[model samples]
Target: MSDGAPDSLIPYDEIVQEALRAVVGRVLGEVEAAGGMPPGSHHFYITFKTGAAGVDIPAELRARFPDEMTIVLQNKFWDLSVADDHFSVGLSFNQIPAKLVIPFSAITAFVDPAVEFGLQFQAVSEVEEAEPHAEPENDSEQGAGNGVGSEDGDDGSNVVTVDFGKKK
Candidate 1:
């Protein structure tokens, strides 16, 4: 047997990212199959790029989060649907509901604190170029939902932040 490292001609990052995005799709699909958020699980925190292709965010939200934004999918959300290329969900802000269409390529993080499970991905690109490492910000201390507990009591309302950094 060879003891040397194996060579790779394919871009592993792209392949991994694609696979991760598929996990997001599969999760959403499960939610859809259930006809709603599972019992005791009523929300999600989906963060994505504001400028990525196929991302449809409100002008106000876009301005507020010019580069990235995290959306809460809880009691006030509706019309949750997922497609091969994108997913759409309706959310309320100030009691005004808005529909957002986010492409999987645009999604950066997906979290469901109730189960302590999460996924992170690199932004998708339309151009045929090498996918860059646009790592998601790890703001667990600032309550960005990285599975870190807080002073607040445990009500299954925790948020999970995605960390794209390699474990050292």
Candidate 2:
């Protein structure tokens, strides 16, 4: 080839990202349909942009996180409602019950470390750089050990992490 590959006119990256986000929705919808308990040892660590559009969380939580927040879907969550573009669930923070509504677009990562499976996505919303926040302490009494899985300490071969950096 005389010239390098031309930049794609098609928005393949966006298409692929949206498709992966749908996978998250489908998995959550199945869990919601199955009475809110993930099948067997499959638990999730879902990270989302706290300030993204259509994200409805408590003001206190928003203030605390102010950037990104990850929640566990294992031992203690309820009223999970999954829609095509969003899902809502009830969780606890500091023993206080709260409801969170998160759009799939706001999600940045979805991981089920039980099987070392994960998906990383680029943030769908524009966000400013900020200091890293602390891990959320949801009321997961037995929530997959540390809530980020990897308890077995195996190499993370099953995780899917994509980097679509364009050629310089």
Candidate 3:
């Protein structure tokens, strides 16, 4: 399986990641277009880097989730707004209503268990209008603020994480 080809000259990995992340945006945009999550069934479990630049979350949720958090968009969320690079939503945590603004570049994982579909990306900060985003402060290579998951499906869900073992 080794053709002996060297490393890629172009940042193909980053390019592919961005395109995949766009899927998340497109899905959310559809929801926004419908005025909210469609009449029934579909939902999302989005996990993102809280410390990533352009991420605006409540201090309490920030303190609680710190590096990352998984939010379920099923019933309780409101005022869902989708933008070109980010999305804003209102959700309740422990009876506290809070608003969060997260840039697509900060999202590390997106899952829709109902359809058994999910995606995990190599977490990177995306460029924003006027201000360039910065890499989130973290101590892990797996990114997403959360620790690494198992190679097996033990981590739960049918999420498929693609890790191209190419030389950097």
C-alpha lDDT (0 to 100) for residue 108 of candidate 1: 75
Q: Which scores higher on lDDT, 1 or 2?
A: 2
Best by TM-score: 2
The residue-by-residue lDDT of candidate 2 on 1-168, one tens digit each, is: 546667789977888989999999999999999898999999999988787778899999877766677899999999999999999999999999999999998887788878778887776634323223423353233232222323323574466655565564
Best by lDDT: 2
Q: Over the stretch 17-59, how does candidate 3's per-residue lDDT look in tens digits?
A: 8888889999999998998874468888788877777989998
RMSD of each: 6.5, 5.9, 5.4
Tell me model 2's lDDT, rounded to 2 decimals. 0.78
How much is 131 displaced in model 1, in angstroms? 14
TM-score of 2: 0.81
Across 1-168, the per-residue lDDT of candidate 1 in tens digits comes to 756545557767677887788888877777777775744764567777766777787887665555567787766677889899789988887777788998888877776676765666655565113222222342222233222223222454433333333433
TM-score sort, best first: 2, 3, 1
Q: Estimate each model's TM-score.
A: 0.69, 0.81, 0.77
